[model samples]
Target chain A: MTQSPSAAMESLSVALGERTYPIHIGAGLLDDPGCLLPYLAGRQVMIVTNATVAPHYLDRLRHTLSGADLEVCEVILPDGEATKTLASVERIWDALLAAGFNRRCTLVALGGGVIGDMAGYAAASYQRGVAFIQVPTTLLAQVDSSVGGKTGVNHPRGKNMIGAFWQPRAVLIDTQTLATLPERELSAGLAEVIKYGLIWDAAFLDWLEREMPALRALDAAAIRHAIRRSCEIKAEIVAEDETEQGVRALLNLGHTFGHAIEAHQGYGNWLHGEAVGAGMAMAAALSAERGWLTGAEVERIGAVLAAAGLPRVAPAAMGVDDFLERMRLDKKNLDSRLRLILLEALGRAAIHDDTDPAMLERLIERFPRA
Target chain B: MTQSPSAAMESLSVALGERTYPIHIGAGLLDDPGCLLPYLAGRQVMIVTNATVAPHYLDRLRHTLSGADLEVCEVILPDGEATKTLASVERIWDALLAAGFNRRCTLVALGGGVIGDMAGYAAASYQRGVAFIQVPTTLLAQVDSSVGGKTGVNHPRGKNMIGAFWQPRAVLIDTQTLATLPERELSAGLAEVIKYGLIWDAAFLDWLEREMPALRALDAAAIRHAIRRSCEIKAEIVAEDETEQGVRALLNLGHTFGHAIEAHQGYGNWLHGEAVGAGMAMAAALSAERGWLTGAEVERIGAVLAAAGLPRVAPAAMGVDDFLERMRLDKKNLDSRLRLILLEALGRAAIHDDTDPAMLERLIERFPRA
Candidate 1:
């Protein structure tokens, strides 16, 4: 399932006025210096990656950034969602300081979502921010995390409790890196692809249902199209609302429920995409409960998630109170009200902070469990 | 002398377009709820102060915020420049989460620069940017740190290595708080006050020279005028360059040399203003070395610092290389060049990055030592 080396690259910009940046999607972009060299803030570059991703892409990136007057260094951290802490970010800062890297230095995030997030935060706070470029290897990162400027680490009580809204100079998504992605992780990535369709485009949702098999089979064309379209929708939304002030919260259709699962199970046990998969289903069911979505539409969503090999049921051990408590700590909530993203219909979503507590409890109580 | 309780409150605005905020200077502002209540983003408020200042003003602040429907909480950190670390900021974040404070909550920083910096960073990162107000008690904070949007903690390698440019909703300067400040600390704060005069206004510098005794004696009118003028100059510069891209670097006239002294002596020992005082003298001497100022002008600068009871020499133990190594890591530097802000005359300062390394070494080697 190797992508053709000659596949043309697609470039799109996340328009944020003065902070606008490009998202470059192609096969073998990591091996091409042209994709990375222009975005380097200066001659100094620090590549931040993790153990799980280093053996595969670190050397390739180093080779691409080699030659010339560049002072390139690296900080290899431990892998997994559990390892996404401020301590790990500190390691990146330590390495940067040890190398005497200046504010002009550029940080290249060379792994999946965890690496991208930590590296982005390191860039955000390092000497009050330096330029950074994202080289996402995971499908989930390419389609979601890497595109948005949301960068931070998980706090013990709540996820992403400490972070800043720092955007990158560019996002270089080399689709070829997905060759080594695990099956579960690939399915996890599809959960977000399905999400964009559920929230923004019903037509794209139809395209996804027809193309899920090809997407799962690692068909290069299907994968590239999925990544590109996902990025486009995200860029459009981010352009409209760069800081999640209004329309952007619609992007978190399943995140409240998903974060609950992740926190309850400890971070690494349930993959973010897996939790998102089940969470989206729960959101769909709730939408149906509110009469905004039809029962058949909810069933359609569940089937597509199943086709993508994502969980469509909540973790059996999680009780209604477990979900409620974790969701209460969500960043989206204002004051006392529980703000949620609910679908009005396929491809359209809205924020609902007035959901009846008893009805929400009933929905969670009767929700199917795995 | 006690400031008249009926002294009229003077307010000015830091014009940053949509992010513009007001700065109020008066007597007994901490006890005035009308000053603090309007700036709160929501009903939730967290008061962040240090142990030393808490006993003096915490209860007064709590009382000011108590009567409303506000859910007010507080996190009192240990006092000292040494306590300005990420760990302390984490404690603030932890307190906010434990209290169930949401995105719309506001944080009120009530102490010196260290407390304001940590609390501001906490507000900046909590839920990815919450509202915060600055209630600076120390003279140095009132004149300098609280007015600027710069907030962060010091890393072992460098001061303010991790931070963000986060502005506050308002800055409340209670002139009466200075009544309880230690003489040594008051002198330390005057170092920054002298700085405002030296860097931007020669007439102000002359006025400071004449009024140093009144300022040191805590003349109610003299102290109030100095704080207001210093803040006015700082706010004008900050509004012109919020992120330190251009004119803002002039504000660091003596900071490069000062930071080296602080790092060598350890943070709390030298005090930031003391270091800056000596650093300003060093900058004046170097300006003479570069023919930008006459020897008489340089001597005048040193004499003024001494009049304010601030040091005019680097630490005796620090060698030439010790100064160079620490100053090289200063945030103002661009790439490999050591960017220094040096006096051009009695009041004007400019950044010079092409200073001869040998000349800088000789300046440090021959500079007076305490």
Candidate 2:
């Protein structure tokens, strides 16, 4: 299902009125600053990137953005999931304020999920929300975080503990940035890639299985197709349920359980996608135990995750009680009730609120150890 | 223009889908939590108020919201613009986290513009944006801050330095909250009420002049009508340019200059509305000097503000240089170029770029006071 280059890929728009943005997914799209320029609509531009990506592409992005009547203020931050806290968000806000950024100015977030989320959040909160463009450097962000319009800083209590659902005016995903992304980072991005298959697209799951090696090799066509499909599924879900009221909650397929694992180990202990990969496997197994998913289907989900170099087991000493307690704090939880999103079959999912706590405890006990 | 009590007033809805809320304004509506109940969706509630209002009406608000199964956790903060800082926002976040607030929970803000901004920011950032209701207690908040989709926490460097445009689920103007409000606070609110008239509605300005006495008397009918008109004017501007793109920028009216006065005096020296009252007089004088507004109009606007018990002059001995420096840090400034909203006529405003610094100096000199 991989599309050839110049295969007529188009852009999708997020409709938030004046804050609306187009998410472009295709080869060489990152090099396309013209697509992002129109959104600025003003003279000044300040880009917030990270240490890892700045060395590789900041100059290119700067050169592209440097035009008549524009002054670019770039702030390079340390790269990692642990960096998405108030300090980084505040630092960026400081830079913008120090640079005398005003209401009409734009803040460009040019990095991975953490970078984009923190930068977008800083922009969202700076002066009661400024215009920010998402220049997602990591595939994880290009597909999931960048397009969703969820921006925030993590609190001591939890990840993304503070933020706003501020939509971006434009998203630039340059495949060129992936050339510098480490293999481990690519694998982390794949967890979300595989998640699309595990939740609502069996055919895409089959395609990922067939294309795993080429994707592993970082084939441009394979990566492009994966990004587009993942974004399309996410965008559709967002359009239908922008606020996660109903169908959007289903999008958190393994997220509710996955969040607990991340919180238990601490935010940066387990990379987000790695944990999701393992959580999805656990969810699949739970579905199989409930007779909602076939054993064969569950095995197939594990196979793709394994092939993509993701974990299929939980932490060795993490207790079921601690996991349940953390899930209570998850954004998906309603009135402190643990709402679990379980797959009934490939390409189909359901939110199961009627699960017995004892039954969940028994199944959690059987989850494979590290 | 004052509407009678028991007169039907429409509930204005902000069109942000799930983020939408009805702005309930009328006599005795503050006691009616019914407009908020639907949006509460039966979720647990946390009442975030300030010291000034708590002793006055926390009991009434609690009784009104004391439906079965609605757990109320009240966090009372100090009253003043000084309390709108991150220190206060963090206190609120800490309180919410300690109380175990999840996404399903709602934050009810019951105070002046300061409390509304700080608590609304906590909601916007708390768990990446939760539902919040605004029960504006001060006249300034009722006529201005409560309507627009603006929320933020202050920084040591500036007012509303860190924040977002997270609109409330519902804005309850209990008209009754104003009864206990200090005369200073009421006069401060009148500054913004006058601002509405100066910016986009000359008729509103004329009406404010006519109703100044009743408003000063705290007539429930006068208060409700004034609040509703202000909301409608703000909502209309917000709709056309929600993020202050163009016409929305016009809504800044006296705010650009007023924010400077607040910061120059170190945030709390002058109540927000009083500075705005004085700032509006300055803006009108500037407009008149530029021939955009007639001298008669400027005099009329001044008389109204004076009648409202607002200052029409700047703090004496304040340097023009410090004033310009403070304005440079304002959200309205673009790369140090002050983007000011000036009057063309009553209710008609325009954004003026390339403002003469000399003119600002002279205006400050003429308005300097004790």
Candidate 3:
């Protein structure tokens, strides 16, 4: 990101074959949604938001979209990961339909991961795939969830267990939303920021290591660069493998292991990004054990995540063996064959097939002590 | 159709780019599940059916799929358009997750329109688009619902208001299932069968007008041919326009008026095909009123549906003005713009856009005394 990596700006594309969409990263994006007005159907617009971020910037978004032949319908759901369920989706769907939304209606989701995930799924299933504009209101959503078209409700059995790969028409990330997010939430969001650096951009990791203090302070420029770089990396991967057939799986670097921690602890108990933070540590540990990474690379991963206030060590109560068992249910498994995404150093992540269950068990044994 | 007009089997392709699927039509084809086995993931199978269809042919299907890792989870939802709701979908989602189904699972919908619609939607949203096999057991589903990939539950405000364009991995129609269908249900199914002929396949409508008596007596060969021909025609139209862009709306020849009747009557009061039967008569009346058709064309539509034991007329209690208001909330409406599929003559339908609302009201008057 030296020299701003093209101050001209970078745009990424999520290739879903016919449902493909673009992710624009830059300043002043929220001020202009004109680039996405083509997909906006009808004159009526409904922006579904949450409790936390509504006070800060809902008015700004309202003003931006005021030009469209649309009536804004805003229904603020409780703000949290726990709110991503079928119940929340029902409210959004009912409000839209009861308010006289037709097929040509567009729903704009504004907020963090939960809001984006829930709102995107609502749009996907609402009347069977209405147009949804992503107004992702958190670093977690903008850098990660908002870019991918994987929209759905979390099942009791697991997170994102029930969802569709429905692409959003557009995603608007106002960096200003970060000012209101708590430091803890912001730290959790950074785990994803660090994920892009670790999985596919070693240089980005180095940059993160250098800018850790500034990012920790919620420096706007540093945060914006991290999101832009993370999105560019993610969009490239998604476009190559939209349905998670190949490169897409690589995007799940620490996710398979991370999903385990999140589910075992109960979803909200372990913030997805925090769990991913810890899982990346476990993955680095396992990768080192497999000779996929050296001591220095593993340590660098730990250092970066910890510097961002993300959890680098496993939670004290997480039993290693229990963690391994939980991971078996991850969708990344093939015929119940556990597939783990391993880092081949800083700049690359490869999906390792036929992972040694015994090694996974060995890694689990070191859990509490980890 | 009487003379086997299917040159090269009348094939049409649904162009979804990569996720594209094929729709096949023929008689007594349900006995062959070989074409379906490739799309089935894992041996654990859940065949969702209704009580009505279970006693008819459930054993044969169970025996066929029993060869694989087919652990059948059969759910019997009540039969009727009224049964398509969220409660039923929840029942399905719970059953799938409770059974420890991961992404590697298959749901086979083996019943009529209600079962197919619900089961396909269950597959669509369950884990965000799982592979589903559609085995439509009724004429209405075989001809219409089973194709087009429209799967959804009805909302209190409207019918077929909640659904997705979640295409099935494969659709299987066992023409033999219609043998056990009640006379009224069979006649209702004919409303859709007659629909394909009136909208796009004019020659087929001519054939149905001739085959009405044989179909009324439940002639298996004629029933099978009608089902195949109607499906073939629908598949072609749907393949050309999967999402009702322009040509696809023509497929809803009677639905604009028909859906309103179903909603006003509180659904299930009149069978889907019955409402469609009367709705088609209303569409013809509208066409005549709009001067697009002559009295003879409207009379022919009324006579054909009436001879088939379809209502061929609307109920008088719900006045024309009230019916038009109900049509305003139609899912097909793009904003306040009305979309109606009308027949220029038997076997020739076109979407009439920007039609005068006052003219549509007068046409509804004829249905009261059809």
Candidate 4:
């Protein structure tokens, strides 16, 4: 059942002027060295993955790369959100130097969001910048984080508090990788898939509603459509605002609350997608209260997250004060004032700087605890 | 004497399209709060300096900052090129997070080149990028590194081996700070001043040939002219090639050879410009052998370096083999072939990719041993 690499593959370009690159989406991209070779800066390629991911696909990837006349180096890191740190990036830097990698070398990020972030940041800072390709193996990465150039690692105080906005040479997304993903990881990734529908495309949201069961079942066509639409929405936003100066903030609709959730629970306790799912529910509820969305619309949002097996409520341990404390540390906050992206409608989102503190507190208090 | 901030100051802009910034060169700029306040992203400013620099200028800089409605945070680092490592950058990251600095916060680099490089890198990566101001205190910084967007730290493998092209919001160059600089440091700064003449302007070179005594005497008008001209040449080149893609590399005339000398002697042993001074001599010799410049022209280059108190010879300890080994690690090399910026004639330079190893070895062998 070996699928040809070029068979029915789709390519979407991220038009970022000189840094523009293509997103190649297909079922068997990993088997095709040509897909990765063309984007490399030189004959030397460094693959950065994690311990968890390496045991599953590293050898296969290595075997594929062996066909090309390129020098390949591998740096496998400990896996998890908790492992994302400056120390981790330093290790990669050390490895690159030890391997004699120069500016001409390219780094291939071969795992989920954490690996992509660390590898991308490594490329951004190594020798003051080098070329890197994203071979995102997780659904969450395929749909959102890997598409946009927002690469970074988390801090003790906040998530993704340290990093750079370095775009990749290309992103290779193989839907077949989803077959090996853990059930929770699959559901967590769906949170972001659902988010694209919630924030930018209402009609896409309607499609998600009808195809919820099929998406959960990992139906080929349904999942591919979900990932493609999500990437299209993300690519469009990222193209316009590469540095998150303006419209790019719309992409963080649930991320403000979600980052707080992940930080409070401690990174890796609740997957990023799960926290984002519940966070989006909170955002929807707040938008409804602000008269931007209907109460029924809020309920619909929660119902989808529930069907997607994502949490629609906050952890019982996290009280209103805890959420406030964590959210204040968000990068979006200015002068200690919380700024968040709120939905004006299901398909429309905007940055809100005037969120009332008292109202926000009450809103956090009212979220279904635990 | 309390000098009026606007009494007599020079401002030059480094045009980098949208990321263009101004380099304000003058005396007593540390006493001027208005020049710094306008470029700050927010009221919070983190001043990153080194121990050697702090004792001389920190309080004065802090006092001026206090005049504005700003929250000032200071992180004093150990002084020396050896302190420029990822570990130092990590410590700064910790202090920043503990201080609750957000994306809106600005990092003000208030020391020499090492300080500017590290602090600028911190700004580039912190919270996925934040605004930074470069308040370069050394002659080398005010004229060269501070004006360019090259920000980085040294790896155990090479100098400036890890960094980014993070542009500053503005660069504040206070010539008054140079009064406190050491004699050796002043001479080291002259190397870069001489570099402007060697790579771009023959008239400037002739001027240096005549005014070398006045320039070394630290005559105010002469020194200011040297600094301004150096920055002007750097700004023009940087504007044309912001990322070192083409002609901008001419600025690294002596850097490739110089970096090898610095790394071989251990960083901070030979000041950056001293290494560049000797490195420039090596490049001059090589160009002469290639029939691009006369051997007499080579002697003139060496005489100017000698007059400026810069080393006109490489370390006798480093053999041709050692130089070749270290030079191979340079970022400019492609496909393991050494690509050097060599002089086609005095004040005119070009990138030389067709250098023969045997001829290069002979050139290195011919260099007078120290």
TM-score of every prediction relative to native: 0.98, 0.92, 0.94, 0.97
Worst 10 residues of 1 chain B by lDDT: B1-10
Which predicted model would earn the best TM-score? Answer: 1
lDDT of 4 by residue, B134-185 (tens): 9998988988889888999998788898999999999988888888888888
Error of 3 at A241 (Å): 1.1
Residue range A222-323, candidate 1, lDDT tens digits: 999999999999999999998888998998989999999999999989999999999999999999999998889999999999999999999999999999
Ranking by lDDT: 1, 4, 2, 3
- Residue clash pairs of candidate 3: A43-A69, A43-A70, A111-A137, A128-B163, A163-B128, B43-B69, B43-B70, B44-B69, B202-B347
Please tell me which predicted candidate would have the highest lDDT against the true structure. Answer: 1
Candidate 4: residue A26 Cα off by (Å): 1.1
Off by over 4 Å in 3: A1-10, A15-18, A33-39, A368-370, B1-17, B20-29
Rank the models by DockQ, top first: 4, 1, 3, 2
> Candidate 2's residue-wise lDDT over A1-370, tens digit each?
8554334446777665545567876665555556667888477788889888888888888877766468789899998878888888889878877777777788899888998898888877888877888889887898898987888877778777787777888887777678888887788899898888877788998899999999889898888889888888988888776767788777777777788888888887888888888889888888888889888888888888889998889998788887788877787777877689899889888888877788888888878889
A234-285, model 3: which lDDT tens digit per residue?
Answer: 8888888777778888778788878888887888888898989998888888
In order, the first chain's TM-score in every candidate is 0.98, 0.95, 0.93, 0.98
Off by over 4 Å in 1: A1-7, B1-7
Chain B TM, cand. 2: 0.94
TM-score of chain B of each: 0.98, 0.94, 0.92, 0.98
Least accurate 10 contiguous residues by lDDT in model 3 chain B:
B3-12
Instruction: Give fnat, all candidates.
Output: 0.67, 0.85, 0.74, 0.83
| Model 2 lDDT at residue A86 | 83
Model 4: DockQ vs. true structure: 0.81
